[model samples]
Every structure is written in structure tokens, then in C-alpha cells.
Target: MEVIEVKDQDLASTLSNNSKVVIKYYADWCGSCRLFNPKYKRLAKDERFQDVTFLNINAEHNPEARSKAGVSNLPSFAIVENGEFKETIFTSKEEAVVELLNKLN
Candidate 1:
């Protein structure tokens, strides 16, 4: 599975159409963001997360996008499905991602 790099303008359209979307808010300079990168990619490749659409948005590059998504923290994950924001999972752990995926499924 490929991760989609999202911009502010495309947020609404992407969330509206995608059945399951996992939007990650991250900053380049953040150590936690860097650490979580591989886990995020692995989650995207996992069979259990196959139905989900992974979107990565650089918070520093797109502050407006981050603000609109209510991302007050770095390395945050928002689970959206069918245009609804299901859950906002925040943690640096890969297991947390797995838990969120299980909850969504």
C-alpha cells in the first residue's frame, strides 16, 4: 500500500470519498515523528490495514491543514471512515496503531 501525501485543499475530498482513512499529522523536525515513520509504513503494508487509506501530512509545511484537523500534537493519527472521524489515536507506539486498526475493523 502506498501512502498519500495530503495537502490542505485535498483533505475534504479525500476524507469524503475514502472508505477508511488514517491521516497522520507530523513534523519533520520531531523525533517522535521520525521514529514513528517506519511503523506507520509497516502498518500501511499490513494485511489488516489493507482497507485503510493512509495519508501523511507534514504539519510544519501545512499549518492550516493541521489546525483544521485539530492536530495539537505531533505524530497524531486520525481514523476516519465514511466521512466521519472515528478516533484520534496519539502515541509513538506501533502497537497503538495496531489497536486502532483492530478497533476500526
Candidate 2:
């Protein structure tokens, strides 16, 4: 699936509309966040997570989305299932993101 860019206003609706979602919170100024972009995109196409909706929200600009996802660091990932927040992970490691995706199962 494609990674969609979500804004603060549309966040709630997006969460409610999708059954499984993995959101990547990032800031343009953060080097680690930039570096993880390709990996994230790759994961979005991953067969294991094909049912999941992939989203990108700029953490520095989208306060509502950031807070809703419980973001605590520069590069954080959140999983939402059934319109509810399931888990969050703050990491630059692709393995860590995969680990979080596993929780969705």
C-alpha cells in the first residue's frame, strides 16, 4: 500500500476509517527520521503488513496527530487497530518497527 500523508484535522477520521494502521511520526530536520524514510516505505509494501494502512505525520507540525499517537521522540511509530491506539515505539531500527508490526497480529 502507499504511505499517505495525514494532517492533524484528518487524523481522527483516518483512524476510525482504517482497521489496521501503522503511523510514522517524523520531523524534516531530524537526520534519523530522514534516514528511516526508505525503510518505512519498504515496510509499507511488505506482504506481512499488506492489510495495514501506512501513514506519515510530521511530528513537528501536527500536534494533534502527534499527541494522539503518543509520540515521545524524533522517530516514533504507532499502531492503531480498530480505531484505537494499540502500541508505540521510539526507534530508528527497522527491526524495532517490524517488532511493533508483529504486535498487530
Candidate 3:
């Protein structure tokens, strides 16, 4: 598993026809977002989530991606399964985010 940095320009294509993906919506200025960064990256490299695609989107720079994911807060997580938007969890807690990603696996 590899964590891909997503930009506004890549959002559409990234989400299109995606089988399984977990997107972390974050902004550089957010303290909580910064705190969750390391754990997010670690989870991306986790063996259990090998089949899942991990992505990171900077909300401030990628408004379209944030809006598309219905993310109203920083450090949110969105899951896309089988080309359909599944759920979005607005939380900065690494544990919560990891729990959600584990569900995908």
C-alpha cells in the first residue's frame, strides 16, 4: 500500500471507477491534521490494508475534493468502495481513522 497525495485536479479521476479507497482530508494549517499525519502514513503501509488505496487531499488547496467528499472539518476520512462514495468520518483521532480503515480491509 502506498499513500498518494491527491490534488483538486486528480480528485475526479481518482474517485472514478475506484474499487477501494480511503481518503484523508486535511489542511497544512490544521494542528490536528498534522498530528494524524504520521499514523495515517503508517496505516497506509500496514499489511492488512494492502489492497486498499490510501490518499491524502489538502482541503485548503483542493476545495473541490473536500466538497466532493462532503468534508466540513479538517482531518476527516472518506471511504469509496466499488466506485461509490460510502462514508465520511470527521475526526482527527488516529485510532478512529485506523478503525475505519481496518473495516475496509
- lDDT for each residue of candidate 2 in 4-72, tens digit (9 for 90 to 100): 999999988998899999999999999999999999999999999999999999998999889887898
**lDDT tens digits, residue span 40-81, model 1:** 888899898899999999988887677766788888888887
- Model 1 alpha-carbon drift over 4 Å, by segment: none
How big is the RMSD of model 1?
Answer: 1.4
Model number with the top TM-score: 2
Clashes of each: 0, 0, 0
**If candidate 3 were superposed on the true structure by all CA atoms, what would the RMSD be?**
1.5
Instruction: Please list the residue runs of candidate 2 whose C-alpha ends up more than 4 Å from where it truly belongs after superposition.
Output: none
Residue 51 in model 1: lDDT: 91
lDDT of each: 0.84, 0.92, 0.85
TM-score for each candidate, following the candidate numbering: 0.90, 0.96, 0.89
Q: Put the candidates in lDDT order, highest first.
A: 2, 3, 1
Residues 1-105 of candidate 3 have per-residue lDDT tens digits of 678998988877887745789999988889998998888889888888888889998888988888878999888999888767788999978778878877776
Q: Could you tell me which 10 consecutive residues in candidate 1 have the lowest summed lDDT?
A: 63-72
lDDT of 3: 0.85
